[model samples]
Target: MTTTAPVTTPKEKTGAETALADSWRVVVLNDPVNLMSYVVLVFRKVFGFDEATARRHMLEVHERGRSVVWRGVREQAEAYAYTLHEWHLTAILERNETD
Candidate 1:
């Protein structure tokens, strides 16, 4: 039988390091153009959030005008932001911060 070597993660290598030392942010912004119901629906359809969670986020957008919806690796965050844009929502990617 063939054997494979175990894989090690970055966090495993650097025990004291923060995971987001190299992570990215995905921000979704509010828009007057989209209906509230549509925003909730899109959040649910795109991120698989339930109605309550999606509605909460949509409400946050309505009140605050923007929200950092997700955080992860840069490439993934950029991809997600782009996907949200394709869905006609405003989105952006930024480097995650420790502070």
Candidate 2:
């Protein structure tokens, strides 16, 4: 048996588009409210990043002002940012500058 993918025409975008092709970053900002370990856990639990990477990103947010937790399509980036917000974490979406 063989499977075939469906065909569709590319639609033109109306509003402003990002620099990169289907890529955005979910950034987490550093705050005085959350604990270091808690931030790591949030990265792991929310973004599914492993402990080491999570800790690394968490540290970046700690020492620096923010860190890009994830990079993907805008929809996913917004979703992740919203989830982090729900978890009481500061997060935002940034369009990928490099395509």
Candidate 3:
């Protein structure tokens, strides 16, 4: 007599689970409280961005009201956004539209 492997079926993902699988963006929104210099400093400290790159993102937030600082998987984006918030920056997570 011989044994055979059992069959298995893949489960379909629900809407919320599908949404979580999509990419996410970490955005830093401009706020009245944080100064331009301080924003740049925080960007550098939190993200390890160099002076020029940090300044670029800071200016984007200052002039454009917000900047997409990082884009990646949802979990990491959430962590980055949370870290920025912990640093007192106005950071938020947004679903990446292109995903």
Candidate 4:
């Protein structure tokens, strides 16, 4: 009698699945050009962060030299970084390894 091996199929990922699989972060670096209040305003405008939240992130950047302003898929993270750069804040994207 002949035996046949079981067939296997690769699963496809949807947009959300792919996004969740590959996480990214948008980080803002401290710069002398932008005031803390300006950074907070940008955060509020770009990210819709509340005043307290914006201030918290601004303070983090001030004391730590860098703050992770957002975390999500690469596309969104890149967009956020670009917006921050346009606002004259130093920003960068990094892969989120924790997820």
Candidate 5:
């Protein structure tokens, strides 16, 4: 009779799994420089948000001082933040911090 230890293999994450694991948020901060209409326009242009949706997010930023405009993988979040910066809007990336 012989005894042997069982081997265990580590699971590898697929692309979708990795993306879900690395979720991020694109938050826009309220600023004194840009007008509300302009912010709405940028949101529409950058994200293809409809007028009502754009205004909703714009209002959130205006009233709350910040709004999370988008949530997705890190790369897309970074791209959105960069584009918002180019449009002169204050934007940042934050980890999702939830499952």
Candidate 6:
């Protein structure tokens, strides 16, 4: 008797899976350790935001416990979160539930 190999094919992603894959957010949380000015500066440097825009995000993080700084695909969101962590900022990745 001869044995035959089985073929395998890649599966397509479902709508929910595709939505989840495209939904990610990078958030910065306020911490007593870092100065507000520093956070603003970092935001500007990392995201190329203008002084006003950076200050706006900084204020959001300061007043509100956290701020969603960026939203995009998982890889880039993770990268931004990691980079912020490297900068000694309180950053985290979150799933965008609305997606």
Scanning candidate 1 in windows of ten residues, the lowest lDDT window is: 11-20
The digit string of per-residue lDDT tens for model 6 on 7-95 reads 98999999888878789999999999999999999999999999999999999999998999898889999999989999999998888
Candidate 4's error at 70, in angstroms? 0.6
**What would the TM-scores of all predictions be?**
0.78, 0.77, 0.76, 0.80, 0.81, 0.79
* Model 4: colliding residue pairs: none
Task: Give the alpha-carbon lDDT of every model.
Answer: 0.84, 0.87, 0.89, 0.90, 0.94, 0.92
> Which run of 10 residues does model 2 get worst, by summed lDDT?
13-22
Best to worst by lDDT, what's the order? 5, 6, 4, 3, 2, 1
Candidate 5 wrong stretches, greater than 4 Å: 1-17
Q: Which model scores highest in TM-score?
A: 5
Better of 1 and 6 by lDDT: 6
Model 4, 4-85: lDDT tens per residue?
Answer: 9989999889887777678999989988888888999999999999999999999999999999989997888888888888
Whichever of 1 and 5 has more lDDT, that candidate is: 5
RMSD of each: 10.2, 10.9, 7.3, 2.6, 2.4, 6.3
Backbone clash total, candidate 6: 0
lDDT of 3 by residue, 1-99 (tens): 999999999999998677756879999999999889999898899889999999999999999999999987888888898888888998988888765
Question: Which runs of model 1 end up more than 4 angstroms from their true locations?
Answer: 1-18
lDDT of 2 by residue, 1-99 (tens): 999998998987744453366789888998999999999998889878899999999899999989988888898899899999998999988888754
TM-score of structure candidate 3: 0.76
Candidate 5 C-alpha lDDT tens digits along 14-78: 98778778999999999999999999999999999999999999999999999999999899899
Clash count for candidate 4 is 0
- Model 2 scores what on Cα lDDT? 0.87
Steric overlap count per candidate: 0, 0, 0, 0, 0, 0
- Write down the lDDT that model 4 would get: 0.90
